[model samples]
Target: MNDDRATSTRSETPEAILHGGDLHAVSGRYPDAPQPWIDLSTGINAVPYPVPEIPPSAWQRLPAKSEERILLTAAAARYRVASRDTIVAAPGTQALLQSLPRLRPRSTVAVLAPTYEEHALCWRRCGHQVHLVDDADALAHADIAVVVNPNNPTGRLLPRDVLVRLAAAQRRRDGLLIVDEAFVDLYPANASLAADLPPATIVLRSFGKVYGLAGVRLGFAISSADIATRLRGELGPWAVSGPALAVGTAALADDAWLAQTGARLARDGQRIEALLENAGCAVIGITPLFRLIASPIAAGIADRLACHGIHVRRFPAQPTWLRFGLPSHEGDWERLAQALGSSS
Candidate 1:
């Protein structure tokens, strides 16, 4: 770790800073802490959609090749896409992300700044001239553009029309566009631009967040059939496990669960947002499961909260801002509020 990077975490109170894994890491370090930790690091739903118990038959049998196809087909349908138009199935998005750059290393990639670190890391490691663009204006100049919808940490969702226009413009330059729609399932009202994106665009989604099946490790890339075919050829078969395929198919097929889970998260998120706002945190852009707040003393606040067994996430690049995720239960939030109040 860079000295500069390590310096960033020094004063942060675990409670006010909300980066993924920070809360979990802190709790792991101090297992005997009295109060339960509040993890608002990753934007995963607190009440993840319940997974139906799988049948013994599912475990006993080798997940047929068709099972994987069915999961992908269901995902395409859920996103209102054609089955053959894109490639589905990866051991989470990380597998594809790590291997993808090798396929298009010569493709000059421009990733949005303060976004997911992996976008830049993986591409750069593969010898691509990865440019990190912070401002929307800077993006207009990049040949190939990458964006994170409802960008992690900041919780900012780029306008759909704006993204579409950018993608279309990139196609004119024969440049590809990639959008990670990992959080889009949380906001269904805004359609993902991937469906209508130009032929060169690729959209990635993880079934982990919405379904709360991160352990299952299912993610897919939506692109033109040509790209999908090529990726499939490169990725080979059985990229997803039998259990993951079964669980994903089950989760996607259940519309009632999706609806109920969305509503529940929206309610819980609002309650948490109010509590944070009441504590003088400005939660301008919040999703159903997480909120991003800016505080001049965010680092100090985070460190204080950590002593009380509260953990949050913070980005070294953005010292004054923090991300907060909802706790697993309502009682967790009540305790979180008291911790924040006491620290203040």
Candidate 2:
């Protein structure tokens, strides 16, 4: 999607951010709200990195392997990746998440919990022994371990040295450490395994969250040369479309945009913290793209916010927690503020 593209502003309409899962499914409960939802659902960037106009030819031909090379080169530089030999570009991290398990033999896999659900789901679907653990030591006896850095929902940062040590332990057991750094672009200072990766460690990066280009479906895996070759050989050729490759290459090359966007998101995150605090909710964890608020009335607030045509994320595991993404426009902020003010 374009940088300026946004989800539905009407909670009743239920955009991609909500789909069949949340607000729309409960719209009947909030029939009095206005149309055009002030959606803050998901952790996607409200102000996306600017995308360059695509040439018509990008859509006309099959993507050449040469185009994939350019995209990988740009990604390597942008990510400060250890080496080009370590990177494997895929359609999206979801695709990588699903396929990575099958690349190796089935064995016990431990995934950090209170994180993205896909890691465990994919591993289980692939017939691996799946264990959910809260700490890194949980991977000790497993053949594989999955972690989301600057963790989702909590904004928890596990130190790199700590993870490197864990990777060494996993390595000794003939296991691999997979780190998902999907939200790391906005917080590079927060412990990342991307640069100078340790032995037997693989890092996953998603292009959609920071760039606001989820529709383009671009993501990458940074791993050993052997693993990279296996993934490439497995996916075959033209795994990424020509237009996505063209757009992603241009986006990754724009260092100025990335820097500016990081600063802007930091500021917006602070604003969200204040907004939630003023709304009588405790802002527990926040990243550049979103904030997690704890409120006794969280579920009620979510339903009320939907009544005001604003959609924010609510976690089933943490019944008293709500997550709010950055609101790009002044009007969007005002609407959210008004909704929070009057909802109770």
Candidate 3:
């Protein structure tokens, strides 16, 4: 699509899009639904890492520079990035996403779509001409290109080499490439773009998804030193809280917990897919944290699940599709199965 046409189509003020994990909103819609809704909407890990005890000072005092450095160091090691200086911590990846567009002049932005809507919304809010494109090749045509690796909902994973080539193209034109690796934690280390980052490329990682600590709101941006410095300046000092620093530092270093959780999530992922298939929904995507399925009655099924106090994600743009995050416990699994059987 042409930039002028795309720019004209976007509203001057973008509307906020619906996101998962808002139990209150769902409850309000389905007031008669059972108590304690099972929220299988976001791709966050069902089993969260055990939070380590925080020092009293973490709450008592403002975050110290040294504490932030420690967290960054741990994140750097975990992401396999060589230098901590190339990383910048934020309150969450959402914060970084909002700020990134302001870093550059208003220009053409291409987002790989039917994925997270926030990327397009954020860029458009910053006065960029944003277009949604399904083709990775179309990304080269934009001044800034945004891709979600192991993409949300669809679980689409672009090869590292393909992204590298796109990044290189953007670099040659003094453009930028933004890769959101929010769901890549469960994939092999080599699947990430954080390691061996290309020039003019920024990688956004969400600590919340893998660790299941979305409330703590910790995330990072991996980029060239200059870009990292620029992002740091934009976020200002102590952008991350003291408790978040403490929790993130401890959690990122726990290699054993990561391995164990990855295995469990993998098994649960398969189980959910099987359940959906048996319920007559075609499973289309497989990421360790969630599954995407298609059924002609997807909206009806979502409403049925909501009535049963089980909330799964449904897309307005694609009424045939639904996304299911892993259920945390046996009861949740059983509840979901029964709901699906009835919905079918």
Candidate 4:
């Protein structure tokens, strides 16, 4: 028998897996454009919190030694934690996450998959034994468990009680639990797990997504003082900047803006959801800025929308899935409906 004939007929692995929201790459392929494009790939707040009137001092002064620490303390109070007990400000959650595995070296870590790739990447880079699973049930026995609450890309959330239970179970095993609440500010009532964190639990929140300040690189981790101290040590001193310190504090201190923004996003998200579902697309989850849907010809749809000056996120291999952002202007939704209607 010939070796070739005895072997399998085909063998190959593709060079790339298509990710959503690569607009700059797409635009590179198609140069002719009639109008400015709308970007829905990132789940950033389109209606950002209005930056407060900052005095000249905010910009001129080298961040006061106490400013960021004060802001972290005040922000922690909003989450109902004692001052300095539950907060550690970093440039952004990404930096802190990259540093976390080192803090818990040798711990058996479990990450929720079909989620943010960064979480797993960071853990693996740190040399932790990492396992990725879809279900929260599989995390109970791990030495450390990490999840993105209202997970990115999917917008799916594990209920607060379930998270509480998972954290409690991890604590029982002398393990740690970490929740990435980057999108939870978009849904407040359903987001109490952070406020009721277990002793071994740590919750990370991003000011970027909610405040539309991604450029500023501000975020924080909430935990008990001991855990906070550990994370602080891991991230090191002056991890955040002065301008970020001022803005983050001002944003949290504004309750009026929080309520108004949350309400507006809820209404807008519902409208977007209904429009997408009506266009024969299945909406998996909803977020203030964007929502995921199943598109039979997702890549084509994204490309077509691009031709029409409308940019949306498409996961190419999974041609049946895409995500779209909500436009605050009522007219943009009408345009989206027409574009999707024509494509579908």
What local lDDT score does residue 163 receive in model 1, on the 0 to 100 scale? 80
Candidates sorted by lDDT, best first: 3, 2, 4, 1
Model 4 scores a C-alpha lDDT of 0.75
Instruction: State residue 223's C-alpha deviation in candidate 4, in Å.
Output: 1.2
lDDT, model 4, position 266: 82
Query: What lDDT does each candidate get?
Result: 0.74, 0.81, 0.90, 0.75
What are the TM-scores, per candidate, against the unseen true structure? Answer: 0.87, 0.90, 0.96, 0.88
CA shift at 56, candidate 2, in angstroms? 1.3
Write one digit per residue (lDDT tens) for candidate 3, span 142-186.
Answer: 999999998998989999999999999999999999999999997
TM-score of 4: 0.88
Cα lDDT tens digits for candidate 1, 236-301: 776777778888888888888888888888877777777888888878556666788988888887
Candidate 1 lDDT score at position 10: 30
lDDT of 2 by residue, 1-344 (tens): 22122111112221122221255655666677788766687788878766788888789989988888899999999888857778999998989998898898767788888787778777766666677898777767688988898788788878898889889998898889999998888665446777788999999999988998887899999999999999888777889998899889999999898889988887777777777888899988777788888998999899888988888887776899888888888888888888888321
Q: Judged by lDDT relative to the true structure, which candidate is superior, 2 or 4?
A: 2
Mind sharing the TM-score for model 3? 0.96
Whichever of 1 and 2 has more TM-score, that candidate is: 2
- Where is model 3 poorest over a 10-residue stretch in terms of lDDT? 5-14
Q: How many clashing pairs does model 1 include?
A: 11
